[model samples]
Target: MPPSGGSPVEPPSGSEGGVMLSDVMGRDRSINLFAGFLRDIETAFRRLEDSSQNTTVLAPLNSAVEKLPRKPWEDPQDYGALGPNAYEGGEGRERAQQNLRKFVEAHMVPLSPWAEGEKVRPIGGDRELWWEERDGAKLIQPDAIEVVGIAGEVANGQVWIIKGVCHLT
Candidate 1:
């Protein structure tokens, strides 16, 4: 949380800051990996851009992303069913895109200046997320992902650097 009891109002463009999400995240070094991940997923990138200033981006740092068990576009469920050819052809491409989309969506909350206690279902996601302060840290629920800091504030919303990835499925 930026400030305790900060104004929870939603801006018309979903941001009071006069900036774009792409420019903010794309240029920030700490958020580079997450930004590139979104760029690879066309619709997911657009969704975040379209959501600008109005959403919350819980970006994982380079270290956290690099530590993932597999690539963001790779989902175990799909792999189990489709096997090694899961990402081989046109169908594979679509599945990869879908997995990428899910990954990106899980990192975003539909509103900006969100409160700590309110439960929120991320954009294009079914799971609910919420956070609370403990030991001077804002930790998001389920995985207790830590909110490291604010990466950038764009015209659409603020990009929060988080320590862990939330579960998607």
Candidate 2:
């Protein structure tokens, strides 16, 4: 876990031998929307379980997810269709899954202890992201979402609770 001032709480004594990313997010109420989303995406969950690679999860707060202009699975191509259930059946189901995967992956950085200004390709997409500190807050960029604090420090990496949504598709 990060130092106490920038982290919600001190990491549990067993952090190094310890909790997984899923457990961390699942237990944190502030990021339940993202935690729920993580559960629904199996591949993303698998990535979280892969301790061989370092990963940092930039989970958006529930309020941040709620304030999004559109749901995570939505794409403008879906707008070409009629109803809200655009990603509901047949090929749409596959499309929905793909869209959802990208949304979750966008929040995941492939590196842990990610440097403050070093840009890196995300674990799942073409878009690269970096961090910037404006005043005292560390923000993920391209989107400039504010990272509120470290939610958990585990063996694999850290989970950051953020204040804004990332990719929509």
Best TM-score among the predictions, by candidate number: 1
**Candidate 2 local accuracy as lDDT?**
0.75
Tens digits of per-residue lDDT, candidate 1, 58-103, equal 9998888889998888878888987977887676776777777788
lDDT of 1 at 14: 40
Clashing pairs in 2: none
TM-score for candidate 1, please give it. Answer: 0.83
Residue range 1-169, candidate 2, lDDT tens digits: 1011111222234333456665576778999878766766776776666656678998999999888877777777777774766766566666776777788888888888888899987777787788999999898888888999999987778899999977632
Q: What is the lDDT of residue 110 in candidate 2?
A: 82
Show the lowest summed lDDT stretch of 10 residues, model 2.
1-10
Task: List candidate 1 segments past 4 Å from native.
Answer: 1-17, 51-53
Question: What are the RMSDs of all candidates, in order?
Answer: 9.0, 8.3
lDDT of each: 0.75, 0.75
Model 2 collision count: 0
